[model samples]
Target: MANALSFTFIHVLCLLLHCSASSAQNVVFQPSFLTIHGPSMTALLYGFSSKITLNLQAIPSSNVTGSFVPPSCVPGVTQWILTSELIAKTAVQVKLRLNRSLRLCGNNETDTDCCVKPLCVLETLQLTACEGNTSQASLIIQVKIYALLGSGNMVFDNSTIIQNQVYRPLGDCPCDLTFNTCDLWCCCDKDCSTADFKLFRYRCLTGPFGGQFPDPEYQCSVQSTQNSPDWFPFLCVTSPPENNPYLGLFYQGNTMAPKPGISFGGSVSLAPALSNAYTEGSPILTIKDQYFTIPQTLNGHCVTNAPVAFLKNLDVRCVTSVQACPTEFPLQTIPEDLRAVVKNGIAVFVGNVVVDVTDQLATELNEFVTSSDIFGSSGLVCENVTLALDYNFHWKENGITGITLTRTVGSVTLKGNVSLTTRYSAMFLSGDIMSEPNSGNPGYQVGRPVIGGILNTSIGNDTVLIARSPMHLWKPVNSGICSSADVRPLLFGENSTSGCLIPVSRQNLTECSLLRNSVHSLQGALIEATLVARNGHPDALTLADWLNITYVTLNSSGVEDSNSSCADIPSHLHIYLWTLVSGFVDGIPQKDIKAVQISYSLSSWRLKCGGGDSAVCMDPAETQLLPITSSVTFIDIPLNTGPPKTRYQINFTEYDCNRNDVCWPELAFPITRFYTGESYSQALAKGLILVFFFIVASVLGNPWRQIRQIWNTI
Candidate 1:
């Protein structure tokens, strides 16, 4: 009877499986969503209706419904079960049921491995009725199922294997740039303890990389250890091996050749060919597809392939052989386009029309070379030649209207084979006014050359004119003696002291008057151009803009004594200047030259006599080394206003601690202690009481006896 009933139950299950497969649409199972682990096969199925119902006497409530429980279930350990008698049924109610251990990876083979997939098989579900407390009646049902996959990568997608891993949190300590040094007001620095942090109430939090602490992220990464969900291990990052893009049976046998990779060594791009006119930032071309290059210095060597930038002011000085002058020099040959524009009076256009200035500057090449032949009959001779090529381009709001080239060639033949210097400079000119850049828009910036001008009187114009130039100081060249050959400029906002030994010409017993006058004249020439005003605003200068020089005489009464020896001559010149700067903005201070005040003074020193006697000084004619020195001193005077504020203050104080040192300790150190609720004495008393109780308990417990017994056992 039992065997016959089993056969009948199997027959009924087969009929139900056929009916379910025929009734439903021909659904194809996605191999990527299917996985087999150990003895069972699981798949993440989709596309089933939410209202699908399965009628059963034992488990009537068991039907397809939307759920996230199955996806979160553990394979092998978590089981699904339902009872008819129990009012509260328990089972893994999920629409897409899958064994996470059984991944659909084709590479996985062994049971312990996660990369391989197991074989597929047919599964049947049996349902038995709760009859007279016995297994007399039962029913069996089988359903043909297929897995439905979505477009994007979900939990089972293979693309989720290789996720980018973040090593650390973003912007951990932005102010901590220099190692071992504690940045002012930086809270993240480990060197700054509670006591040091008390000095500054605020932290340096500015710019894109500034933050107090990193914010929380959703993905699993290094930050997950700080703050993350409980299931972080299951969602941990994975790195997969390189293989075909699409995996599974559906993508099998589709043999499409892989794409060829791009090569790193490709053809180089040539410079743009010259059109009608040149544009800004474009390479200045002489002819069509021919670039006009000048000798430029790279690593202290001259290179001829450097192209000129349009409308840019530059001056280059480099050494080169004299034989390469004809080819290396830029002014040797002029282009036809430039000549045509000059002859026809055509307005050259650089994206717009050009209007010519009234002043007609001549283009000339001045050569001051030696009369001797460059290539002598004996051998190839070289000299210390100086080649200066200047290009002045007149431009307005539209474009360049006029172009003028001036070349100055000077040569000095030395005893040996000395290289020549090739000096090239280009600037924009508008009539009599040349385009001079200012060190600062409203104030003078540091590291820029000091702007000075020689005051002059114009013929008809009432505006007081000044020949603009930078302030130069005497520096020794050739030998170790000061001369007019080499002089460097003084940088603005820089305080420097420089001196050199000058040879004085002594014919007969001359008084100190001649030496005094000579030294004063040389020092005076350096400061003659003294209008320290903004560019294009020389005439409208105030009292603060004028800088004057005061000569200090030999005597205490400020009077010169010509009858004294050469020691009475002036030897040093000191310059004093002040700049008005505004207050701090966003912790960074900005400087400007709104009001300038400058003054200079000359001083004299006694000279040492030879042989401890005045015999050498009294001689009729003798050579002496006169020391000449100059110094610059810069003083900053803060203004009432300052730059824009970058951040708000965390806590206001009584005085500015950053600038003023006379502030009280209370205001400077606002943070009294780490914890504000308790006093020092109270905390000490609590610690003492706790220690006393701990000692008393230890004595009564007699832990030493237990320690001895444990030691003996060991």
Candidate 2:
């Protein structure tokens, strides 16, 4: 028996050494001797290899069963100690040698007698071991065997944690997966500091129990109950910690559950639908499964795939590449079925430019493309390249009603691909008026156009009707001067400051007092009217709501002579617009323009009067340049926070648990003892008497029946 046991130990070590030698390149452990079949007590062993050493520690039957121990050898004499030699970096030469005094039941004892003493075991047994450290009993080898005659066998199964294992609280902590980082007020995350917990202003994504079951705080709160406590009935659960309504049974397991998938699965879809109104970060959908995109300038080049935002006005020109011409452009309007509710009509008229849905269907331009009509007469295919496209969306309170697209087609080439300077603009208008644009729905939003009108006192009550336009900012051109070509409108909630140098010749500044007047007129060009909430909805705004300009008067009090150099041209204009937010709709702030304040600055530039050109500065030909710098700053301010509203209300009352069996009127177990008309003492007596009767009857009935059977036999 000793020889056979020694051979079995050598066989297991040889198999492990061979496996380790073959699998040295891979670090992943694959043991050939351990095949975990299932929960059933059967397993197959294979010689698998890994870089780590496996230690086997035997647990005595006395230690496991707490009573049984084989008497074959003395108490402390028989020992199963497994030793190993590290021959390779990835391999271990294991040699398990049991004491020589250890005896086998198969050689000298019957199978039943051996099993009763657990003496006669199989020559070879399957064992599962875990890797542990040197200072501790690292590995525990559990050997399972069945059917001593070899008819059926018990399976052995186990898992190993090499060095360490993290056992957090029982339930799932999905958001608390980051080890040392705070997971946004995750209740189960111990890494979160007090400051991190203070940031939990809203509802907790993971509850206080951290996804654990039998949470009394959340389940038995005041909102969950309908009845009040008895004796003192006005009491309501006020706080989450103190709101514990007693439930009799509370059993929970403390086992960590594993997530089903260990890795990311597939792509997530974030496609937007036309039937729904555009929200934050919503993508613009068009026909042919393409996004309706506009060119955005990035790093001195146009990215043509940038999508246009809904309800926001845009006009941009950039040199971009395009395939073909009019045919390739997104011409098809949004489908009618997918369209949201439209409160206003479809077409909008903008002075000479009539924006209608039918304009997109027009094949030839009236003045631009006159003498052409899809000509194929002389093998000449005049390619109508789309130079510009203007998309005007007519909308009301509901949603966008119709889209009007007017394309500027030019015959650039006969056929192939070409790059052209393409202009694209998207505007949202209400009904048929293009001058009157809807700033927002009910309240103003960031990036929406700011409505303003030129106040004309000549029209009396219709002063807002003279020339209504969205507020515009002077687009800077070469050398910091404003240009008539580029036009940029002011958007709500965007604060910006810009300046440009208007270079004027010294002679021109002296000759033309009209130069300062011209600068004044240029400032007034974009600064048209009083800022309004919305252009379409004309309100009777007070004088305080109207914007007032600053820095118009120059520092030329004593220098009114024609020979005097121009003193202090209007230099800077600061416009401040204040808005008030009352509430939020769909997480978007609802704001109204409250006040408008405008101020300006004036300064003078002194030149060397002794110079050749300075002597004849008043002369028409002396052309030494004098720069008149002017700046415009627009500041938008909103309230710090929206108006506060009540979140939760509580009604407190005195309720005593000692006076009443059930604190609340609702019946609960254990707490609820006596029913109606039943005294406490009477109920207790009746329960005790019933229990005594049952116990007595169970004890006496069995012997009486046996005695009656004996008497009948006699």
Number of the predicted model whose TM-score against the real structure is largest: 1
Off by over 4 Å in 1: 1-215, 218-380, 383-386, 409-414, 417-422, 453-469, 480-483, 499-501, 534-564, 583-588, 593-622, 638-714
**398-502 in candidate 2: lDDT tens per residue?**
345456666665554322333445567787776876524466666776777676765556767544433555666665542344542344677777876665555
**Global Cα lDDT for candidate 2:** 0.45
TM-score of each: 0.41, 0.38
**Every candidate's lDDT:** 0.44, 0.45
lDDT of 1: 0.44
Tens digits of lDDT, candidate 1, 1-714: 665566556554644553344235322112222222122222211222323222222111122331111111111222223221110011111122223332334333455433231222124333222222322122332322222112113343233221222322333565676688776767677667778778875655553234343222333444455565444444444433211122221223233443331111122222222134444555654423455555676776767668766655666666544443343234243332223122111222112111121222222212222223446444332332235656676655434555565545333443234345456776866665676655644445677777776566663465555556667666543333565334667778888877677664334115566666777676666665555554222333343444443334445335554333444455666766566655445664556444344334445543346567564455535445667777787776656556754444324434445555776554413234433567866766766776686665554444755777789999
Instruction: Please provide the root mean square deviation of candidate 1 (C-alpha atoms, Å).
Output: 32.6
